[model samples]
Target: MQNSYPNRQWIYVKRPEGRVGPEHYELREEVLVGNLAANEVIVRASIISVDPYIRIQQHERNTYDVPHPLGIVQRAGVVGQVVASASPLFAEGDWVSTYSGWQLYARCHHSELTKLDPSVAPVSTALGVLGMPGRTAWFGLMDAGRPRPGDTLVVSGAAGAVGSLVAQFGKRAGCRVVGIAGGPDKCKFLTDTLKLDEAVDYRAYSTLESLSDAIQAATGGVDVYFDNVGGRVTDAVIPLIKRRARIVICGAISQYDGGLDKPDLGPRFLQHMLFQRATIQGILARDFINRMDEMVATVAPWVRSGELHFHETYVDGFDELPAALNSLFDGRNLGKLLVRV
Candidate 1:
């Protein structure tokens, strides 16, 4: 029965020069041409996650994952329902999550998918809080930042998917959390909704001196810095780092769009790191996949009990994936961004 429906997919067409647009992708509709193999199951997408990392994946060559090939579906994490199955592992109507990309239906072996239970939380969360973003926050904080009680923890891109959770984790660990976000509204959401100790609007300050002053006013100095959006915000925060500070480089969204060839040259801050005895480390979620169960055990309760609040910006339709992705670089998304198909 599922074979009767046309499959629509967004295929990568060209390498994005700077910011990716709809022109970089080609949406093609093709009829399902064959039956599922014995080990395969077919999934109908319900929600597709549009992330900043996808922009990096658009390059013809990348170190993070295999570079997407031309005319192939754009890769992304998706939450969907099984509609047809030759695999005994997944029956029709079961919810699953996979790296199936921007497509209406995906047929893959059962090993490629993770089963999700909607009864525990919204299945969409499999692509958000209870999924990679949440795990990124948990492991990156615990492993890289290593917050101590009463320590001043600061996070850039604080209103974002990973950054918001990192702020909450700091609060839970008895640290004073300060968030740096784009605008006044996002800054408000960080303080009022996410309950960070302080929030700084990076957009409000034009110079590094003024930004540093705001950080100094907030928590005196930062002991741990969870950096999601690097560049100017990082430059400002470096001057205010306390002794023996730990800086976790998670995602540099500020540089992901266009600065690959000619990188932003900023003031040399290695001296500050040397004098402060601060340590900086770059982290990838894939490195800590084994600890995902530990993260879920810790964060799932907070989510279920309403202690940890998560926000999501939903854009309807698969065609909006490019626009939804572009929103991340534009600071248009409040939290985890998703496209409901």
Candidate 2:
């Protein structure tokens, strides 16, 4: 390794207004001139996740790590291999994944990482199915939503990373699965690929009325609804929920474009929960990390046996991460979105 390194990164250009575009972020190049400190290691990124939180925050508001101010490198989760190490557990050739955000190389404290076991799980799994998004699905379904046999489970953004896995996991628990997505291809994926009991295309339906009608037909009535996209989708389904239903608020990709606004039939739906004795809870997966081993155990065998399916769209190269993520916001990709470093 060289004594000095040059790293290229994506920087926040300005605070976004409404619909975010390329102009919101700027690709900046910087030179890194350093060596590892005693408890630190240097890693070259292998894969990075293009997630919603990166776009939701202002140039000054970060979700996982600290925010990246305007004209500065952005923060995101990354999977990498250590090229040089000064820590006891991490050594040269060690492969691990972390919350490095969006950068080509990382110099971080060794205590901040867990060594990746390539023999047990594929390296890319750290970014998608076997990692954060997968964990989010597992934690949300089991703890918050708690679907059971014969229960009707509905997941919004059903073809997405967290949504796809949540639907599959709910299926494994013996609940009937219904998915909602933006396009026909994604709708097909929920049925043909993920094998959920039913799928609804939000675009074809147009209004909240049609979407509610389609979901009503699929679920009969949902016992649990895993909400990833908020806006109209939530408005469409909330009133149709079964008595004593549970709603897990995961990510609101729908509302992230702009914070909450008055809804079409918004004020009317909260009474449905009260009348039916249902529960609605918002979740952040990190709150359940202590159960990581349990999540791994729950999904690992299914992953190996091909019983549980994880779908991801990979865009190679460190440079391709952002645009790949933009595709997600535009509903252009299905399943989990991943970047191959």
Candidate 3:
């Protein structure tokens, strides 16, 4: 390997007001001083994730994650190969997953990384199906939503990384799974590829009433609602929830583009929850970190055997991170969006 190279990184330049753009981040380069401490390793990033949560994290007022500061390497989930190691836990050429951000290379402690076994699945799966997104779907749906046999499960943003797996898990549990996505192609993939029982095209319906009508027809009434997109989709699904329904709030991608400042004028759907005695819960994968191994054991086999399906949209180059993230809000990406570094 070369002694050193320019470490290109995307730095947070400004707090986004409404929609995030390339202007919010700046690509900067610095010399990577190739040196390691006793417990440190230098990793060359292969893939970096660009997720909706990153937008929320960049906001000035955020609850889920620490607000991103300006002039810092933009934090993200990454899969990379260890190029140099000073720790016994890792060796040169070992694949690992970590929060190494949007940089081409990272220097991290051995303890901070999870070694990836390429024999189990592709290393890129560590950032998508087998990594945080997969864990989010597993714990959020199974633990929080808790769909049962004969139940009707409905997922918003069902073509997305977390929602896609949530739909599959619901199906595996014998629930009638219905997915909601933006375009016809995504809706088709949800049904044809993901094997969902039904797919709802949200873009086809111009009004909430129409959307609700379509959802109501698809699955009599949702017994488990795994919500990824909030706003109108949530509004449409609210009234259709059956008695004793479980609503899992995994993400609110629809509201991210507008930021948290814009007041939501939607009806008080909490009233519906009170009447139906439904359960609503918000989930974060980090909260269930201890159970990740169990999740991998359960889901990995299905993935390996071709029972579980995963899709990824790869935007090549380290500088494309901004455009990759923006694609999420526009519903341009059909699956987990990653930047190939």
Candidate-wise lDDT, in order: 0.89, 0.81, 0.90
Residue-by-residue lDDT tens digits, candidate 2, 17-134: 5555667778777776557778888877888888876666653445554545776666777888987777888988998988876787778898777688887777777777778888
lDDT of 3 by residue, 1-341 (tens): 33575799999899888788799988899988767878989999999998888888887875687688788998999999998888899999999999989899888999999999998999999988898999999999999998899999999999998999898999999999999999999999998899999999999999999999999999899899999988999999989999999999999888887646675688788888998999999988898889999999999999899899899888998878898888889987877888888
Cand. 3 TM to true fold: 0.98
List, residue by residue over 98-122, the lDDT tens digit for candidate 1: 9999999888899999999888888
Model 2's C-alpha root-mean-square deviation from the true structure amounts to 2.3
Select the stronger candidate by lDDT from 1 and 2. 1
TM-score for candidate 1: 0.97
Error of 3 at 16 (Å): 0.6
Best by lDDT: 3
Better of 1 and 2 by TM-score: 1
The C-alpha RMSD of each candidate to the native structure, in angstroms, is 1.3, 2.3, 1.3
Q: Which prediction has more favorable TM-score, 2 or 3?
A: 3
